[model samples]
Target: MRSFVRVAERGSLSSVAREYGVGQSTITRHVAELEQALGVTLLNRTTRRITLTAEGARYLDDTRTILRLVDEAADGVRSATDRLTGTVRISCTAALGVRHVADILFAFQDRHPGVCVDFRLSDVQIDLVREGVDVAIRLGALSDSSMQRKQIGASRRILVASKEYLDRHGRPDEPGALARHAIIRMSNVSGSDRLVLHRANAEPSILPVGDRLLVDHGLAARRAIMMGRGIAPTHLWLVNDLLEAGIVEQVLPDYSPEPVPLSILFVPGRARVKRVRALIDALHGALRALPGMT
Candidate 1:
């Protein structure tokens, strides 16, 4: 089954055989046996490529589910021993990974030294299966419903400015008033030049904002704001220390951007892996313990 699945995915019998450290004949025999037992042609082979039959496509889905279930069952049995040993590949946004997740992963590894962690930090979403990523930490809404996910926490988006900037330009009492003030825009946060502000029991307002400085990274935006560039909306956790120290103050306190959700996402089939589960648990615990998270 594994060999057949590999062949279907790779579309090359010789490549699959080489990967398994076996002769091409061995893989051919395995596929032949499977087709004979099922009484169906699974693949159409040509000198150039291999294409799956309709039945083969359907059977491939079933095979993947069966294989995943078997792996999950085996993981469950191994997890009973309370020891995890394996490499876990994880993906996460760059800023969050460096500022938050990396520390948690370090602590998790300290606790379970047998487990190795491979971290891929980037701003873009990656294909979990194709990239062999065991798990991903994502912020905001998730569009992929097929993956398994757990909401770890919520990130409140608050508009803030350095105390010096606010004192110099005067704070905006309403969302619309922000149009007149300089704005440090985080381009990655919203694709538009406008900022959307929400208020309790009121219609959301879209305010035109200035683009004195535009940045693609959250940390860069935060730094610009700290240097008194302009007012901008940011995750509360990212500037909690500055807020506490009175270096920055919230603007238009009555209005806020919609809270973004923080979630741990993984392919459904691999969610039950012992190492993946351990990392997920650690993430949940760590994120919940952060300031401003309930």
Candidate 2:
């Protein structure tokens, strides 16, 4: 089972053999024997990469489950003091990871000294299970199935502008007044509907925020805002530094949207190993130091 799984995961007989302290032909024979025993051709040999057959694809999930159970049974007896190893893949936004999660991950690595993490940074919203992500630092609300969420912090979508820009153009008195001004639209959002604005002392105004200027990355949007180009509805964390530095200031405070929950997400069926939990706790600790959550 070990030889079969290793070769499949590594996608190379020689690589697996080297890692497992065995000869290449030995791994090849073991895989062949396993395939024969299961009566399925599990691997298609190739120089570059291997693609699983339909039968192999079906078997791989089951194989992973069996192996996980075996490992847990062994570890349960040894207890957590035995130390945790292997990797946890976390998908998160690029801006947030750099601004915040990176430090927490470094702290986790320092404390654990055994577990390693693969932090995938992207703005794309994806399924954790299908992408082989052990965890996700998800922004906004999640409406997916078969996943649990734990809130580490909270953030509201706030409108922002550089002090210089506000000084030149003057801050708008109300949401409807934004029509006369330029705005930064993020291409990062999945939904394309107009932004809905709510004011504490006035009626809600739903503005069809058009594409005056589109920025793909969050940091780019921050730069545009800092350059006095346009006002942006941005996550508070991304603009925290700029706000403190007086490069940007909050606008339309009364009309800012409801605070969005920041969550650490995990898929079902995988072992909630001690290392995964430790990393999540570390993230929570870091986020607690931020303004809104604190």
List, residue by residue over 165-189, the lDDT tens digit for candidate 1: 9889998888777878888887776
Model 2 pairs whose backbones collide:
none
The total number of steric clashes, by the backbone 3 Å criterion, in model 2 comes to 0
Q: List residue ranges in candidate 2 displaced over 4 A.
A: 1-33, 43-58, 73-82, 190-193
Report the Cα RMSD per candidate.
Answer: 5.0, 4.5
lDDT of 2 at 206: 84
Find the candidate with the highest lDDT and give its number: 1
Clashes of each: 0, 0
**Top TM-score prediction, candidate number:** 2
Q: Distance from true position, residue 153, model 2, in Å?
A: 5.5
